[model samples]
Target: MFNFLKKKELHEDGTFDESGVDAGDFVDQKPLDEKESEIYTDLSIHPEWHLPEEEVYVYRFLNQELPPLQPNQVSVYGVEIKEKDGGLIVDAFVRNSLSKGIQMKPAAIIILDKQGETVARQPFDLSAVGTIPGKSSRPWTFLFPPSSIRDSEKEIPAQGWRLALELKKKPTKHSLDLSDHWKESLPQEEAQRLHQLVDSMKPPKAGEVNFFGLDARQADNGDLHVTLLIRNGSEQGLTLRQLPLRFEDRSEEVVAEGGFKLKSLTVNMNTSKPWTFIFPAESLKKTGFGFVEMEGLSSTEVMEI
Candidate 1:
């Protein structure tokens, strides 16, 4: 009775198909082409591991370079620029090559507009990490807010601009001050806590001990517990005798600090060691402290057993 009112169905290719079903619909489609398979395979890899975007513009800058004055003393590994919070953040990784430590005091980044005129000269007070150890690299980040650069006489050209790092040279043979440079900036109690933490661990050597996957939070008892995933890059097993750590605020002020001994001293090579430090309730103020800024391995030796 109502069968005559049913609408006809059409296949994707646009022909009415009144049969129960067509042979094409039952048959399996052909396997994807070689090129199509490759596309699916490429999507599996993480995008972060891919190369930096390559877009053409007016300005050109080198990502990495060796300073002419003391090529043997230090080298800039790379520079990365990121936009955050309506500002530009510049991160520079610098390495020390000399056996002696190198200081980056009077450190500043000079931004130049077209025609090579200085647009803004922002100085960095890396008091937190005043000196970098020999054979090690550390990151220095500088932020440029939109309001900070809006007053510039010359705007950043579409062609791009230059970012030059100007640093003063200070060569000291392992005599650089390792104490909490954040002393003046942090609260008295916080500064004292940091000073105590750094005192326990010795300065870390590059390629010796590196930190990753750090986590920190307050415990039920009001103490601050910090955990770090540390990797031993050396060939021998490491028995940490002294490990010091510090937490700093955005202003480079120390907030919480502490360290602990490993129950099992010897950590195997190419293995990750989980270390936790606990700061007493009174170590930090009532308010929440900021992120981890500074940490180091004070004294350690190769374990034979």
Candidate 2:
């Protein structure tokens, strides 16, 4: 495999100097259209191989300029939705606008409601869709059977709902540090996502970090496992040695309170990190509850050590 990573020289001023680097080093060595299909074909067992010949042609298309995909850039854009055979058929465009010819692995095709809530989800062996060339937007029909439908019995409204691709893998990369200007090196979609995530959240006061609740669940032992998002919108990174947390319930009552030791965990400016903290059974004041108030945290005192 060719390394798509670009190596550059970082200077004391945080600017990169590519004086000796050739511009052609970044260009793809082989044209995507010229790539042999042998490398793109997956010989392993796949459910799509059993599909009818006519149905198989729905997603199969030829791409001459198959370019490499930037991480997490593949997405589908829906053009039409119709009811057929007591199921839903989505005519959509599988877009790989970032880079190179690529084939997708098997992944779930998700349908979202008007409110962006998942109404249906079904897995598909996307490799059968064939080699999708880079800078390409190909049309394909995805059939979601009745069994996969979770929405109401009423017919799914075609005009309102949206198409979405589930994150097949957990994201390991986070936003860059305040001083790092290298986020430009990231895929355009990824950089935009991180930027929007930070901007969408009403930032905390200047020079301060906000700890908000993302999710919370009570285990069988009544241990409240809470997932918190540490959002840093400051100009520099900050270290967390300790944080006192109060878990509140739907009634605005504190169900659990604890001081979590973070051991100098650093949160870079303009970045967010999620950490799950388990409030021991003994520490919880309530026995049975769900949906802890994550928004109420805004008014809670933030203690940083």
Tens digit of lDDT per residue, candidate 1, span 1-305?
Answer: 00112211212332211111111111122222222110100001112223334311100122112222122333332244445675566544444433344554444556555466655566655434455554344544567776646444444443344455544333221111212333345487854554455344443443465654345677788887765545555545567666667655456577666665555555555444545578898887546654453344222232222
Q: State model 1's lDDT.
A: 0.43
* lDDT (Cα, tens digit) per residue for candidate 2, span 8-40: 111233222111121122223233343332222
- Cα error, residue 29 of model 2, in Å, equals 14
The lDDT values for all models are: 0.43, 0.57
Q: Estimate each model's TM-score.
A: 0.27, 0.34
- Kindly report which residue stretches of model 2 are placed more than 4 angstroms away from their true locations once superposed: 1-72, 169-305
Error of 2 at 186 (Å): 49
Model 1: C-alpha RMSD to truth? 26.6
What TM-score would candidate 1 get against the native?
A: 0.27
